[model samples]
Target: MTDVQELSDWAPDWLQAITPQNRAGLQVPDQVEDSRLQTPLSQLSQSNHDRDDELKPPKITNITVMPSPNRMVKRKLQGIHLFMITVNGTLGIGLYWRGGQILELAGPLAALLAFLLVGLLSWAVMQCITEMLCIWPIPGALSVYVSEFVDVELGIAVGIAYWFSYSVGFGALIATLAAEFDFWTGTSGDKGIDGGIVYLLIPVILIAVNALDIEIYGLLEVVTGCLKVACLLAIGGVLIAVNVGAGKQGYIGTQYWASPKVYDRDAANDWGTAFLMCLSVAIYAYMGVEIVAASALESAPSARWTRKTSDERESQLAQTPNDSLIGNTVRFSAKYISLLATISYSLSGLLVSFDIPWYHCHLPRLSWVDSTANIDCSDVSDSIPANTTSAIVAIAVESGIPHLADVVNVFLVFTCLSCASTNLYVASRVLFGLTSRLDGGKGQPWHLRLLSWFGRTNRYRVPLRAMIFSAASFIWVPFLQLQGGTSSSTSIGMFIEILAQMSSVAVVIVWTCQVLAFIRYYHCIKRHKNVLEQQKIPQLSRDNVEDYSYRSHAQPVLAYVALAGCLFVLVVANGAYLWKGFHKFPFLSSYLFIVVFVAMWILLKVARGARWRHVDLSNPDKVVRKLRKLHDIRLAAS
Candidate 1:
């Protein structure tokens, strides 16, 4: 503080002595390169500096108070709960109607094969997501993963594709409920419930259920999940019992193949039409398999309080209020459970298919009080139009135990309601995630708006704006069926099935991304290992990095296999539609899946002002940041 303080005190004179008076007097350090040092700040002019300063964030005013702690919003969910909610969502649409259609398209043998193969692929997608959840438990689950692993543009593309595909569920369910309401009330012909009570009720009911605290929703899901599991089991058990009791007469394996003449072996029943119908059926059967990802948001909130002991990071992940242990367990359990639901639904379809003469004139709707109960299904001669799954229950009830059929119908209605609830939740959350301005602390623009509308201290946080958006988004589906004429009996059903199948295809793509992420993670670990080995350092204490590394490496292979399987299903299921007499069929809906996917991606890219140059990974500026992060060994992106 002696000499230095004296110099500092007399800085007015000392600065003049040390400072350069002009360009000629300036003396820069030798270490500074000409490219950098030659660029004098004063010489550059004020406009350049002004521009640079403008690019930076504005400083916060001293008068502004720090933001309040994110209002202690709901925390992250556990792995299990996340898993279960996902399973319930995924299995919802697929089990209800797709199986019977698959049986008709691929034959019993082929349909079963399709289910197993697709299920494997679906599982792969689920596992990849599982690994992702472990690594990054955020609300924008897939979108976040894709952004980090692939380029941000690609991530945004995938997110948009996924969101659009998911929106179909909300739309499809409204249509489905309308169809059900029409059937029960006998107004499906024309001026039916399509534009009536069901459409309005769907949104209102969905909002009511979703607006509750997440824990209440979880409890409801658990109860519904259990019932869904029981329903599938009961359906399977009853079918098996009946088939066994029917003995040889109950089994008609190649009936469709043998009776081509009766069902029409003509131009109308050619491979193309048959294939289109088959694909239409198959698509509908497996539509809702991606619902798992949708459930991730709510699951975290439900298991918010549960605690677990693990890696500090993992424990941190677990205790994140929304990312609790219970949620994780539910998510994982749901994946396997979805497979069970698929198999049960498939078996029930198989049992019913034996009774229907696929190649002949429509099979009798079971004999008892019967002849008048006969549905004039001439318009829908290709497939069972009015509630296909319910049709099977009708046949069984008409033929065997009528009482049990009545009981099953209640459960069937329960399944539809559960599905609608799940879809609404998904729709709202998707809207929330997509519209949310995440750069604004933990809260979004919509979140604050919700807080204002719902009250600040409310435990139940509902994005009312998003819910309204979802409600509006689905309004057209029910009414759209009115334009189809008499053929419209199956038109709404067909539209729903078509869209649902496309969503499944989109899920396959998302699943593929998960696998790719797994592969990248594996390579990252491998690179890290090789670097450690080359250094040849002394023995050091280690974390379970290797275990995680091993898991990351192993899981992707399964994911790849699943990806291949999904592609094969899309090909086989839709192959007949595309390859055989392409124009003769309703290829628009089938093609619409890919069309929407690409169009949405392009629109998102355009909206973001992203171009090929922006996505270019070769740009040095873009890569240098990553290289610096790797070499400098800084904290990871939280």
Candidate 2:
């Protein structure tokens, strides 16, 4: 058996107090005597109460405390809501389109390899986030962590970069959403959709979602997330199955790579450009993992339910008093295993790249002049497969399953729209954080503004002004569309990809911090005896290595691999691209955007009356204490 199993087996019935039943009652301790406190911070209190102590009621005082109406309603979001928010944030436009671009560079084999490699790296980053979340479990996980573990400048830099990336990415998603719908419905006519109507809709819905209580939005995300994931899984499965059933060399199994030009390095005289293009695609796939970190805020407040269930199981095992200790150990081990199982479901999704799909093909060799003669070949022009990936998938579906186009189209549109909605919401939040009100005091220049709009509270505590600003940001897309040139669109995509990729670079930095934090947390866990004076540390009496903190084996291995992998991609692939100036126009522009915004964030820090004295490291407990008080005040008002 494993240590986790053993711990689950031995866990005592008394541990039920840690479950979600009383999560609202949770309070943070005033201080930590030593650094290694193992218990859930929520259960800790400044004054230790005996196990059998009776609950005490609060005393009324003579203070004139006028009750305030509930300023905001707290709608309990279902688990599905959490799921949609996560899925929508993570699975977006790239899944449907970018696969073809990657396929063009590396062939099918290389494309699959890219997905696999990025997926594993993403999981490592997520685990780091998981550890931090377990420790602090606050809203705005990245911003909070950056401010806490790293320098304020690093945090501000990352935050601004991230917000910009999300905003631009949101615009891209809206465009893609319009494209998907256009492909399905054959309705490209303008109410404003293809840069006109569709772009306008993005921020309106975003504002509406934000204006409502967050839980409502969360619920919608979970529902849509389920639909999106289910649709994609069905598509991937049916596509592969249909290919197999058709008895056509449907699986292909790297046939795309049989052509030497597909993988041959010498074929690419423009190696710098080729590699930059590949990095650009890979970064698109990697962008969503940060969404996972963004979601820590929405997890259930306490593990008390887990504790309660564990204790009940332990009590049953203890019925045979003669076997009390032995049976209890077994039960405790089981509890931990079950908790791990719950976490494992999310991990599976994190690991497997159930990403968007695209089309791939090869055309007969032709010169530029020959291509001009064969104008129809424009769809698949650039020396790679060029059919409309979306249309191809839809056609394949319609052909394979008779009259299935309607079903496929609906699924496709839903997936696109849900993802678009999610992108818009996240962008709004990012914009709220970035656009400061301090510099713009009541109406400053556009360049000087930062989050001033978001500071304006609404009935539900939503940032109405910020939402408007975010909506305004999307208007840039129509201007791009009004130009109406393929070259211009391509340039726009590349520019968005560059900024998004740089933000991804910032994500890597954030992930590195999280990995370090998780490693530190594991060390803290290893010192469990010192952390938990109330309970004896369980003995590891098993040889099975899988039962311990998988973090012990898996996390260390992944950390080194990911660090080395990121370094190579950034310094070698991306660095070479920058050095060679192949895509320097957009490349330099992206860096400039990042640098200017980072400077803005730093300047705002000075302008906002921020001081080093406010930079206190009171530990996670202190932060939780403040949050608990806030929660209490909210409850009292309600």
Candidate 3:
């Protein structure tokens, strides 16, 4: 008989064949049986796993835990998609329509100062967001970070308020779109086409665009974003040319700014009050700049998915603690986009002032009866309102270029459509994030279970239910138009203005929450650092503390500044009611979102039976420690 050692030297196929045939007689070798029995199960299992692993594909981790709707969403968005989404969101109908109104209310200097101040605040808020997102990229993470770092009740309130803001903003854009159609057809009187038809059609278009794969939506945004950027740059250049004597008007210079009457007080009847009011308009222009942070889950690096083992993931994370793809993109986009937007806003205000004097700009009185009637600002009327026309188009028309005005009107229509689509996207994602926290645990309330249904994804991994619900906000457009009489352009414009006021307030509140959350997060890090120092552990380096993937300048100081700015805007913007005698329209539109936020917080707190003492700050702090441990392990491994 051949010895087992001699059989091992032969081919395995031949050995198997011989062993099976000679099994009963071959088992006389006790040495071979004892060697097999002595083999460890772990070694045998590992060998078998190795053979099986070679045939299997790599495993990809989901963005969220199992059963989460976010888990179903594919990370298809790249850095460019994120950039375009943000630009598309930030640069919209607000700048095109409200630019002239802001200048009319507050002169060129005040408008410029308001925009610059708000731009700085926005930049600071974005820095806080970038720091948090780099460490944990999650969809709709704004509310999540607030919830973890602050009170859960406050988080729920912020989420609901944000969702409301975007939803209402979507409806406002739809109204703007309908109004634009009226502008194109030159129909505004009793003989005008039904605005309701256009309102219905706009929502349908938004739903169609949002229902497609995320990649397709992203690509669409890229096209629109490029067009918007080009359009703005062209408008700026044309405005410059017109100011420098390109048009028949000839070299206007800063004649408008030089006039003292142009800086007359606004509705509040005070120059300081008028300047404070412009802050809200400026904030509205930059409302959606933070969408880049919201898109972090989809734009995070693909390196996270390719790790072969847990150890490998930890090692890689430690080696590059600040190597987030989304973080880098956000940092780049936030810095340059904020700067560009500030310049665009200030330059547009300056040029528009030069192109058309404040007195000549038509500020429409927002009334249900004949809303198109212009409020004469020659006397600096008590009711200063937004312009009933696009400032860009107005500038072109004033330049003796009717054809250019037509071109600009077309661009404005497209801008409204693009912004409405983006608003729906944001609203739906916020709803998804809000519902995802329910977890469908046993004994959940009926309302929570109903909301959780919207958290589910369809075949394409899109939140179809949530999106459809969000799109329902457009229904308000038709209702407002047909309120008392026939639908008119003025009514639609009024609706848009009301929604903008509400949305602006919501934006300020959201920013305030984010700034406060960041302050808490900063303190959390400090506590961890203190503990490390006390224990004599190697303290985190200064680079680790300050310069992560994106460095937010001035630490807690910038955060405090942002916080103070947001609170100031929140109070002063709505304070008009004190002097205006609390008129229903202006008062409700400005303070309605604030009321809703407080009510929602109280309701949530009651439902959860939550107390201030029970708030948890440790979880977010633990995240910091976990990353540090990985860094330490990597050092040891190397």
Candidate 4:
């Protein structure tokens, strides 16, 4: 065997946490933390990944041996699949009820404006994440990127916060289902299927669908996305036809805009409340846009689908599907999804402000959340609460065509079902990937080892246990909402708000960290570049200044701008409730989500203890280990 000094000499720069001066007695840990997902939480302490040989794949438990080869996740996703995934991922709440919030807070014009501006800023945020994904090409991307580019603890913090957000967001979506169920009972000849039955059925169906096969999951997204695209087109066409006297409204275009007010005209706070609050609601609408990054590592490119040819061979030589091809596909997926978001939200802005009357413009049940707002459109038709189901039903009732509303309500159910399934899928993978990072072979703590089991994939290559655990986490919230009844919506209203509040906080923080992580990533690369130049050593034969495949050009600047813009919106978005004094709760309620996120982060730190203190980059004794594979990609691509 070679001496330790010889081993140290051959280590990749990114993998070198020990310097030559102290190489004599140094004992490097033999745990490779490099993979698409990087290392687990336990592996982060000795943040330097062990060599590849040290990272032999963990033996799969043959407790229940299966016929097929065991893999954590089947890499079956393709371009169209990823494109559909992005579409479903980004356009969740926006498709159903978010239009009403925008229309209510900022009116039609401002709502449309809110979507465009926010979408642009959000896209900027995506650019940062895309850059990271291009370089890293890893699973559990957000946490892995944050750990390597920023701080490992911060990565764990982001993972936890994101998990909480997705969990609560799932509940928020489920809570609204009750309002949609109202449409059927009120209009469908009293089928006798109450909201409770719908609630119970949704989770079971989703779990079965998610656990069966990933191909089914991809197929589900494609079918649902096509239907959603069709629905959006139909809704837009309806808006156009009705405005042009196809309906009795007779050239109704912009008439409602003029009457109910073009903007909310919250003239008090310099009209900022109208725009800012709408921006806040708009944030939720576009919340899932960045999901492309989360799933990119698993997204299979066109090369995976087709048989190779002579022409394609040259392209393959230049780029493999894993890096450039996959990166391009991911970028394309994000683009199409963002484009869809912009079109849908803008069209909805026009359609909702015109169709759903000003008075009926309450929260859009989310397409049924706050039933108190549905008082007008209730079974008795006494109070009309502001929601998509209620507003459309109210319009249909006014037009003496109640059946149409039933169809729309049914359609909204499908929409929410698709969105909820996606959320559950995201939640399970993120939580599983987070826990997987802590896997420390057989020598780890009992608790750590026990939790690691939850991350294991079953026969279908699905994190079956993690999926069930995630399903169970927020499953109870909606049940409570069902029990609260729509009479006053007393319990449901507060509960949804709390969930939304927490979700808003956690998601925003996670997003902000992504932007900040990019900045740190740029600095890390620049530092490495400077050191290589100073030492008169070429890092790679083909490494020029433009070596990075997808550099975040003018990086820290764009990152800073995106970061500031998102943060400002986050502050105003949550606190807008208390801004006008026409609010329901206290300042504490608005900021409660942030408090919860910090609490979760601190608890995680306490759980981790002080083993990782040396990982603090600023410390003099800190051991630095950059991602080695990331360097290989830059060299190969360049």
Say which candidate scores most in lDDT: 3
lDDT of 1 by residue, 1-638 (tens): 00111111201111222212222332222112211112233332356556474344433211111112221224334554444455456566456445544543444553454455455555566666655454343344566566655656666666656665666667776666554454344434435445555666656777787777776777777778777778767776766665555456555434543533221122124544443444334444454555555544444433222344556657665534222232343345434644654565556656655544342223321111122322344534332234334444544543465366556556666677777777676766665544342333244465445533321113454555565666566556666666652122254445655665566566656666656655554444444543333222111102354223113224446766765655554555555454434541246555666666668667767866876432333433333233222221100111
Cα-based TM-score, every candidate: 0.68, 0.64, 0.77, 0.77
Q: For model 1, what is the error of residue 615's alpha carbon versus the real structure, in angstroms, after optimal superposition?
A: 7.0
Between candidates 1 and 2, the one scoring higher on lDDT is 1
Error of 1 at 519 (Å): 3.3
Q: Would you list the C-alpha lDDT of every candidate in the order shown?
A: 0.48, 0.44, 0.63, 0.60
Instruction: Estimate the Cα RMSD of every predicted model relative to the unseen true structure.
Output: 12.8, 11.3, 12.4, 8.8
Runs of candidate 1 exceeding 4 Å displacement? 1-73, 76-84, 187-195, 248-290, 298-331, 334-338, 353-391, 437-459, 482-498, 528-556, 566-575, 606-638
Using lDDT as the measure, name the better of candidate 1 and candidate 3. 3
Candidate 2's error at 308, in angstroms? 6.5
Can you tell me which runs of candidate 3 are displaced by over 4 Å? 1-71, 187-197, 246-251, 264-266, 302-326, 361-388, 483-496, 530-542, 545-547, 580-582, 613-638
lDDT (Cα, tens digit) per residue for candidate 2, span 1-638: 10110111211221222332323432322122211123335464435654223143322211111221121223243344544565676665555445545544434444455555555666655655544443343334465556544445555666655655666666656555554555433433344455545667555665576567776677667667767768777765655555455435344323334542343132233534544445545556456555544443333322112235777856644532121122122222212322222232222222121221122232111010112322243333242223234432533443446645456656766766676566556655554434321344345656554444453446665556655665566546644533442121356544544444555555555555455444443443344423333332222111222222122226556656666665555455555444433455545533555456557766867866566433333454544333333222222222
Point out the higher-scoring one by TM-score: 2 or 3. 3
Per-residue lDDT for 400 in model 1? 60
In angstroms, how far off is 8's CA in candidate 4?
13
Q: Which of candidates 1 and 2 reaches a greater TM-score?
A: 1
* Model 3 weakest lDDT span, ten residues long: 30-39
